[model samples]
Target: MARNEFRKSQGVVPFGVGATVDFENESLMSAGLDVWPSEKAEGAAWLKIMEATQIADGRLARRLSSDLKRKIEFFLSPTEAPELTGFQPQQQPGRVFMPFVRFPNWYFCPRCRILKRIAWNTQSSPNAAELKCSNMGRRVEGKGDPCGSLKISRRPTMSPVRFVVACENGHISDFPWSRWAHQNSDKDCDGGENGSLYLYSTPSAGLAGVVVGCVKCNSNRSMAGAFQKDVLHRIFPSGCPGERPWLGPKGVEECRDKIPQTIQRGASNAYFAKVVSSILIPPYSAQIQQILDRPDIWAEIESLPTVDGSVEPFLRIKAKNLGVDPTLSFKQYESVAPTARWMQKAMSCRRKYVIAMMSTRHMEVLGRQSLSVTISIRREFPSRTIRIGSDNSSRG
Candidate 1:
């Protein structure tokens, strides 16, 4: 972590959910999104976010609103207990928190060089936030000589292996440790895929210095060809398994890309986030949005008759709520619709324009045309159109 990263709040760090983060103990873990919290996103801001997401991802169009509710979340921090109350506040399970799962669970103790894999699924698994070396220097035998002996003193800290496999489809999984350790040798180990592994590294040799061995069979192989594009394919023919650990324990999806390339956990291309921004128009804009955002006001507007004359009375009474002069003539309402019908049409047009702009691959050009159109609307119907500014900082 950098010195400036410490100044930012938690959850805002580069280790954002789904990305692996390096710990102080030289451990690496991927952040997971916690779903125990009951908080749901509401108000116009959330609607705008959902709208943008829907526009960006067509697959989400068929997804129910409830299913898409998991995207936005807020984690509440515990506050100090009141002085006079003499009570201590405790953290709750549902109080939005992010959980981490240790990826590349294979860890090797520096002192003993004994590699170990930690249990990730069980309740007794070590906390993902903090993982320590579990090597107790237990006695073990190998084919050639004594593998390891009991420790005389304190246990050594374990460090995570740097290698992990990921595909272009955003699926990531642990590196094939057991396969790499026992490959190229004819000897069979006591445990086929689940065998005791050991790691030895010679810094002077760089990547070639790293070597993985099976303690049971005494088979060892250097990581010389590990970085090759076809090394993983040669080891395992099936291809990527489509593992998505960051979405939770069971977030697997069917991925078409088979060739997963080996990459370091801290590599720049390890993860990428797709972000798209959209402009809110008319009734969704900040100023007028607040008035319609009110449940009572929305319900009243929805129940009103469709007749144009019916809106004049409601607008006269609600004009003050929109920060407009209540005494304005009804003549301006000709250009603007009763219930912002024209604004709704314009909003649809803006969506089409935005989609066209995105198809052109020019995102920086967005909101330029919308701003000019908004200004024209404001000028044409000054009494009806609320002067909306470009700044939506107040929105989430």
Candidate 2:
């Protein structure tokens, strides 16, 4: 029976998609409370498992089933949908193609209120023919266009699509989002604000490669893919995480340090990954193992350390290699985009002191030391401001 339940549970998931993430995990991980809230913090501590996984590795959300997606979106509907009751207008898009690899923001519209997925693509051709909605479309009254709009009501969307593997044939097997939408899309949905509807949305190349087919075929294809993944993990040079050997932050960096840290070989990524992992994730393994634990993830982190947190304006500005000419002064930016684009890190401050979120760009030179390239991150995201409390320099 459990086997049947497992199969049923797996039926609705979408394959080749980024894992769903839970904010709750971030909170728990941040505090070093690794045990699942309900379980007693027992034998094998969660910290050990985390360190084993490399504290730097991102904790991806467990793969979700398509049915789970629907349940999640349904719960998110209320604030997203503005028009609660109606003869029911605004038909949903069937097989909607989101242009962006991963959309940053997505939600049901509050004004018109329907499950709407935003497709941000500069490549959308205005001259290209409009793709008609698969279901009934809205028709024109005295409208100039001959093809009238059909009021098909709703189109099945990914928010509720079951997470299931695609068979080689390209059909969605097990549970189907299409059939489910036909029955439930019309129900009263009162989830939440559209902005909050989908926070875990990540961009990927898989959806762009999607090929439609029958469900039975998709199931077969998915199983084959899963089998292949297992094979690769087993036969590859590195075995699944084990005691035989180690290649984590300390070990990987130790090996890399021997090669000598340099941007030339890209060995520095391992080091940076370690930094990102430490700051972003909880000190899972480090604390548990009590081995080489650096509590202040950014102990080495420097943000133009200020003598006073509340310094009014001019405190002691030590400018180094800052090519700012005496004639040039602060020119208010016309558009924030340019600022954000020119530099990757932005400037944020604690008080009057301006802190630059700049990283050193190690440029290798033949005989001399690696040149440091200072980039302006503020130029990358111009919309952001000092209030963001971040420096704008970023070294690519």
Candidate 3:
């Protein structure tokens, strides 16, 4: 295991979460470069680290003074041309908090069941952050403490974990975020078609970093989004979404004029009788005959010609809610039309279902799995439904 990693009593590291920082040496005066063997060199010259007087203090000091320090400071100051983040004392340790995460179900993976038992915050170290393991994943070699899905590399010293995501068409990619976010380097390999994978770049052993790949459409996105929300809570941006709606509740404007109005005429009117048989609503969305005796705002609606074709409902959703009385202005009321013909249809069908397909790589439910759920009785299947599912990724 890496000397710098934190481990728990169970001997595991919190794997597959966003706790890692994009740490680079970013040093103005490299201490180890001068000590490295001669074979390693950059360009046509050996790596040269400007020499400085090295000092040691038994206690960590908030400030220091030295000839070497002054020269380095001249170039490394915050305002300097090559300014760098000041050196931090490596001896000081970070607080080792207990950690746990929740993941999705992986019933489809039999041989990889124990992969879930892979290492976690099992031990603490100052030099390394990982433990060497024998866990060769199904697709990748190195195993995560909880069974890894890391992409593999052949080089041992450069032991980077590649996160390869495969699309349905078999276009597999190492989801390297630095390459993706910065759009620099490795132009030779495009993410390929149907780029649905998300990339998380993190520090590894040496030279290179590890990349954790995930699909945007994985059942675990919500779970992962939740886990990430807390992990990067301080750094997360606004408008962030939870497991479901990132936009939160539907607003009144969103429901514009979708709620139905009372009958324009009295409930006993002939026109009311003609349309009475055509109305279908769940008990929650409907009421008794007397309730309709008085006009709702929608009941006052004077012949605004119904838009032709499929756009009739667009008026309710885009502009206003269903009328409360026939006289109500088209712009007056707003709502998610629970009583619309389509909404009614959506609420009633037994065989009907809704799914949120993934953004990348084609995936489907296991053919053998069956799910049945009862919801408010509706008239027709909703034209839209969101997929609500999850997978085997750690959550906390």
**Best by the lDDT measure:** 1
Model 1: residue 342 alpha-carbon error in angstroms: 27
**Model 3 agreement with the true structure over 131-181: per-residue lDDT tens digits:** 222234332323433223333322111122212121112121222232233
Consecutive 10-residue window with the lowest summed lDDT within model 2: 72-81
Off by over 4 Å in 3: 1-172, 175-326, 329-339, 355-396
The CA lDDT at 383 in model 1 is 33
**66-165: candidate 2 lDDT, tens digit per residue:** 3123111000000011121242323211111111122112222212222223332212221222211221222212222222132323322222221322
Clash pairs, candidate 1, are: 133-158
lDDT of 1 by residue, 205-267 (tens): 777888887767888888887877767886657767777665545777776546677888777
- Which TM-score value belongs to model 2? 0.17
State which candidate, 1 or 3, has the greater TM-score.
1
Candidate 1: worst 10 consecutive residues by lDDT? 370-379
> Candidates' TM-scores?
0.54, 0.17, 0.17
* Local distance difference test, each candidate: 0.47, 0.19, 0.21
Better of 2 and 3 by lDDT: 3
